[model samples]
Each structure stands twice: as C-alpha cells, then as structure tokens.
Target: MNFADISSDIRHNQIIELLLQNNNLSAAKIAAILNISSRSVEKHLAKLKQDKIIIRQGSKKYGT
Candidate 1:
C-alpha cells in the first residue's frame, strides 16, 4: 500500500503503536516514536481523539 495514499492518522499509527507499547503515553513519548516534534504529535493526537481511534488512560510521569 502506498503510505502516501493513507490519511495522516494512519501514517501516525506508529505513534499509536508506541502508545500501546506503554499503555499510556505523553506527547514526548509519541514524538520519540515518530522522530517528530512533540508539537506535531500533539496535533496528530488531537485528530486521533476526534476520530475516536485512541483513548487516554490518564497521564504518567515521563521516565517514571
């Protein structure tokens, strides 16, 4: 499949995968997964939230 044909959200599934890896993740965590800026990840996450493709299980301290 052409990644380019997919929506931005699908492209960021790696971030969601990262979130699954931790069960709960912060902006910083997803940023690390995609190697992108946290600000970009935040935008991706916001879109995902509206799409109901991800859920928050509460926040955790980074490196905690």
Candidate 2:
C-alpha cells in the first residue's frame, strides 16, 4: 500500500483502540488525542460507521 493508505489504516486502528478503551469519546476528543483535526476524526468515524465497525447508541451530543 502507499504511505498515505498505510498511515490512514494506522490511524483507523488507533481510533478503534481508543473507542474500545472509552466508547463515549467525542470526535473533538478523539481529534485531540490523535493530534488530528476534528474534521478528520469525523471522517474516520463516518468510515467506521459505514463499514459497520461501530454504532451510535444515542444522540450525537451524548452517545456511546
């Protein structure tokens, strides 16, 4: 894979690991933890959701 693809995969895995540790994290919180932008975190979250890797439990502001 290209470097960018590998990097994205690594970040995706990290995001999953973080979620496993604390499922209540917000996109902003994940962005801060990953040293990435909130927009990027949101994109990652979208991909995870699309792939059925994760699921939202409630409202965006207070979901787990």
Candidate 3:
C-alpha cells in the first residue's frame, strides 16, 4: 500500500521531516502542529514505520 495512493508523497515526506527535526516528536505533537487528530498522526507514523523511514527514540514526558 503506497502512500501515493491515499496521501501525497510530499506530505508524508513532510511528516518525515518533522520526525527527523528533533528525534521524532510524539504523534500528539505532530497532530497538534498539523491541526489533525492524534489518530491521524499515528496513521502516518505507522506508514513510516512500515517503510522503515523513521524510528522511535527515547520518550520524554509532556511539559517536563
């Protein structure tokens, strides 16, 4: 299932850019910035994970 079928490759690439911007921000963070739902962020992340495009780093608490 290529993202090109449902979403734009450039948009996904932008998501990748965000992930790489700072060790992969949380899905919540991305959604907040993009004005989307966390579930949507998760969806994008899942696709990225499946493609081995981004990775998960250590987690940090919110507002800590």
Candidate 4:
C-alpha cells in the first residue's frame, strides 16, 4: 500500500480506538485530539459509517 493509504488506516484505527473509549466524542473533538482537520474527521467518520463499522444511534445532535 502507499504511504497515504497506510496513514489513513492508522488514523481510522485511532478513531475507532477513541470511540471505543468514549462513543460520545464529536467529530470536532476527534479532529482536535488527532491533530487533524474536522473535515478530515468527518470524511473518516463517513467511511466508517458507509462500511457499517459504526452506526449512528439517533439524531445527529443526540446520537452516539
């Protein structure tokens, strides 16, 4: 795999780990914790949701 792919995987894994520890974290919060952009965090979260790796439980504001 390319370096970018590996890096994305690492970030994805980090997001997953963080979620496991605290599912209530927001995308902005995750972005801050990961030292990345909120847009990037949103993209990663979209991917995880698309893959069924994570699912939203309620409305955007109240979901986990």
| Winner of 2 and 4 under TM-score | 4
TM-score, candidate number 4: 0.94
Off by over 4 Å in 4: none
Q: List the residue pairs that clash in candidate 4.
A: none
- Give the range where candidate 2 is weakest over 10 consecutive residues by summed lDDT: 54-63
- Residue-level lDDT tens digits of model 1 in 17-64: 777677557787778767889998888877887888876554444331
Over the stretch 1-64, how does candidate 3's per-residue lDDT look in tens digits? 6867656566577678776686547777888887888997778877877888865555445421
Please tell me which predicted candidate would have the highest TM-score against the true structure.
4
- By lDDT, the best candidate is 4
- The 10 consecutive residues of candidate 3 with the worst lDDT sum are 55-64
Stretches of model 1 off by over 4 angstroms after superposition: 1-7, 58-64
Poorest 10 consecutive residues by lDDT, candidate 4? 52-61
The clash number for model 4 is 0
Global Cα lDDT for candidate 3: 0.72
Model 2 residue runs over 4 Å out of place are none
| Residue 56's lDDT in candidate 2 | 93
lDDT (CA) per prediction = 0.72, 0.93, 0.72, 0.96
